[model samples]
Target: MATGDTMQLVHQALRENSLFARLDAADLERVVQMASVRELAEGEALFHEGDLVEHTHVVADGLLRVYQVGPKGSRQLVLHMAGPPESIGEIAVLSERQHYPVTAEAALPSRVVRVPREGILQLMEERPRFTRALLRSVAERQFELLLLLRRVAFFEVQSRLAQYLLEQHATLGPGFPLPTNPELAALLGTVPEIVSRTLSRFYKQGWIRLEDRRVWLENEVTLIAVAKG
Candidate 1:
């Protein structure tokens, strides 16, 4: 059961979300009523990689870190941050195999609004707009995956690192914590030594300013150029 405040938060997050924002008022209300809030402590997993899909989630507060762990126990970070109004496992509602390919864990104390798979599929069948929204989500994810593959195949470490920095700066501002290098390395598909060397090179090139656990952009122009390559 959801508390009044938690319910309110879910309603607002769904309204703001890309997939749900297009829903009509009554349809939105119905979906909200079917939703329940889940609270998670730091490091708690909402689901492990390969878990059978039962529900999708909207982050009502804090960050959800989506990743996969290799057989050798190495983490491959898929998404470092999924915060308010962002969703996970939405496409799984349409998946035939119906297993979440990545694990979603709370990077900090977090709140999630759980939407059951059967209910969302039912809504999709009855609502044309909802179905279209789901299709668009699927298309967007595919496009992003293609881009990721292209980058991994063709882009150099410095280019990818520059792109990553620019993306993080866009999402999290320039001075956010540099707290997790190993996870960052996994996200970049490289080792920490290379990431460190790339950052050192950027520092020498006067493209970035680095402090204890934070970085500030000194030259967006150079970073943008490198990212484009």
Candidate 2:
């Protein structure tokens, strides 16, 4: 259960979320009554892949790293990073899943509101609007995952890397300090050596420049060509 200003803040954030956006204040309050705020220390795992499906959670505070294990079981293929007002594990619960499909870990000290599968089921029965909202949210997530799959399955690693760089450049601008090689590899679904080799090639071709652990986007036109391939 949440209390005081923290509870108020959580309510405000949830109000903005599409899942709860259509709900009236009274209905929203009822939803909160069925949820509990859980705090996770940095590196704590909210759930692991294959764990039995139990509860779904939404971020009340801080960041979550959603990922899957690679074939060797040592490497991680990062799926996405979700933050405040975002829901994780909701899909599994909605789908009546038996086990989790991925792992959710705390990227920072975080607070999340855990909502029981049973409780959501009850809410859906009572609130048609809430059910519609959840369906729409799930549909959007499915399409996003489809696009990611298309990129991973059809595009070459170099093309994906180029696209990732272009996206980060557009979002963060030039001279942005990049994640370590291994982290980049996890995100790009490749090995560190491959990521290093690709970046080196980019540098040699004058498409990008590296300095002091930061990247400079030197030629957008050429990088765009690589990304489109």
Candidate 3:
């Protein structure tokens, strides 16, 4: 029942994804043949916090925000983005848990392939190599999350903000427009006005030049000190 275009996109998504890279054409075709694509709308939740773990989804396009419900009845944003081939409910896959730990919401209109848990487990049982590769992917994600936790726990907001800016600058290149004050705040897990005040102080001290959303590191040494402190 899959359309030609849907099949093509699934193939393209799998091909680009590191997780599925090792799958031979025949295996990849089998996966595509078995998976189901589900469409989600903006602000719509794919799963509620504590929902039974039915399927693990891979974002084919758009974005997903993973969050938990706070005691105050607020949504505590955990991860702002989930892109293609990044699987959700991966931990559930390992533990054989019946429920998910957090709610997953579509940040924008999105398409995802929902792989049933039983099907995946069966595949892994039959293909040990595939299971090994999948575990590696999960471990990598765990390491990255640990680093994020360390940042939140040990670093002061200004220092964390500076380090994040430096990272973005490295990826986006120097002379690229720095992120706007608000965007920077979100990345640092803080608010815009506070970020503005901190950045303004740094700007006056000649540590950085912020024009728009781009940050140019005027003094790498000072910035490193800031990140460290």
Candidate 4:
């Protein structure tokens, strides 16, 4: 895209995004001046956990997956999936953390606006509405992390998988595009073999139908009951 066209898209995204919706014209223009666009191909790592935090990124398009790798390097736990207009690395910037808490990767081809940490800090200091919005966004992300942690601690893998399937069904509809076994396992905090076994069990139980790797919900009530357990 042309530089002018990209800037126009960025301006529109800032206006529409919850984090930047409160920025006035002057502040938005300042941000536009200070930001640079970054493009990522699928499977590209944006930043790894423990890397020094230097910039905050706002997704312009496509998907970014935030995750943490296990100590033994045998497992990956997905923390979140961020889409257009969503901010990444903001918590590190807000807290002035020296290093990133998790790794971010492009789940698909993506574009993100990279704003220098210093510039973002300056804006936060100057814009009260922006500061408030940033705080709220951070708090909500923390809450979601806490909830996921709780489930991982207390829920069985089967129950968690069921819950995840139900969630995907609700969000993406009956003919939901399914993640690969390994990806699904990462999201559910397990290994692929286990995910495959459990999914087969679900299939036999008539909880879901899988065709061409896409899942169709067969019975939501049973899945909900399992999810609650």
Candidate 5:
């Protein structure tokens, strides 16, 4: 895409984002100028956990996954997918920290817009409104992170899986193809084999119907029980 077109897309994405919700047209234009847009192939690493943070990124198109590597070389999935208009690494920037809390990877061929720390600081100096909006954005990101933490900490694997299913069913409706098993596993911070087995169990129990990559819930209540537990 042309640089101008790319920047317009970036501006549009930021406009829809929670952090930039209050930004006016002029402010968005400034952000667009400062932002860098780049495309990443699936499995490409955006940044690693503990890497010095220099910029924040917003997904302009496609899915971005936040995950980390364990000492044993195992991958621990954190944030599954970030759709358009969503920003990442805002927390690191707000805390004035140099390192990232999680590693970011491309879940698909994706477009992302990056805003440098210096750029943000400049914007803050020029516009107090932008500074307030940035702070609000950071706070919202923290709240979102807390929700994910609660989901991972208190819920069992099966329940978490079920809750995920219920959410998809609600969002995508019946007979829609869900994400691949591997994708689901990454989202849940587990392995694909485990996701397959869970799907099998749910299918056999008549709680859901599985066909290839598509999942249909037979009795959402059964999944709800697990989510509630």
Candidate 6:
């Protein structure tokens, strides 16, 4: 597409995103002018942990996976799967942090709006509501991180897997497409083999049934009991 058309698309996306909804026409125009579009292929890295924070990104299309690689490169933990209209790296931008805390990779072919940090800071100064909204977004993400940490620290692999399955079922129904074992392992902070074994146990316990990529819940009450363990 033409550059003008691309900018128009980006502008419309920004307007639709709740984080940018409060901006007036002129402020929104400033943001569009300062923004650039980034297209990422599947499994491509957008930014790595410890990279200098420069642009605050918003996913305009497709999914981005936020993760952290362990010290010895032995493990990767999936922190978040961000989709359209979701802001990435906002915490670093808001906190004036120099580096990103997590790596962002494209889970699918993705398009992101890259807004310069200066432009975001300008918006915060001129738009009080925008600042509050950004802070709230950060706080919400922090709460989610806390909950995830609690689960990882206290829950067993089986319990965490059960909870994840139930949550996915609730959101996407019983026939939800389950993520691959490796992906689930990253999300649950375990290895793929353990994830596979847990799923097998679930199947044997009559808590869930898997066919191809789809998962069906056989007994939600029992799954919930397992999850609460």
Candidate 4 per-residue C-alpha lDDT over 85-190 given as tens digits, one digit per residue, 9 for 90 to 100: 8999889997756999999999899988888899888878888888999999999999989988988999999999988888888898988888888888888878
Tens-place lDDT digits, model 5, residues 101-179: 8888888899888988777777778878878877887777668668778877887778879888888888889876777
Residue pairs clashing in model 6 are none
lDDT of 3 by residue, 1-229 (tens): 3698888777777677765667788877777888878889988998998888888678889877776656886325364457776777777777756888888888779888777788778778877777887898788878867877788789888898778777877877887755456445655666678888898888899988867655788988888888997
The whole-model lDDT of each prediction reads 0.84, 0.85, 0.76, 0.88, 0.80, 0.89
Q: Which tens-of-lDDT digit does each residue in 1-229 have in candidate 1?
A: 4477777898899998888899989988888988988889998999988899989798988888887777788647464468888888876778797798888998889989899898889888898888898888778877877777778789998998899888878978978667466667877777788888888999998999898878899999999999989
Separate clash counts for every candidate: 0, 0, 8, 0, 1, 0
- Residue-wise lDDT of candidate 6 within 32-150, one digit each (tens)? 98899989999999999999999989899999999999989989988888988988988989775699999999988999999999888888898899999888888888998997898
Question: Which TM-score value belongs to model 4?
Answer: 0.94
lDDT of 3 at 101: 80
Highest lDDT, which number?
A: 6
lDDT of 2: 0.85
Clashing pairs in 5: 53-98
lDDT of 2 by residue, 12-67 (tens): 66786778768888878877777777889988999999998888788888988889
lDDT value for model 5: 0.80
Error of 6 at 80 (Å): 1.0
Task: Flag the better candidate by lDDT, 2 or 4.
Answer: 4
RMSD of 1: 2.2
Tell me the spans in candidate 2 whose CA falls farther than 4 Å from its real position. 171-177, 209-216
Better of 1 and 3 by TM-score: 1
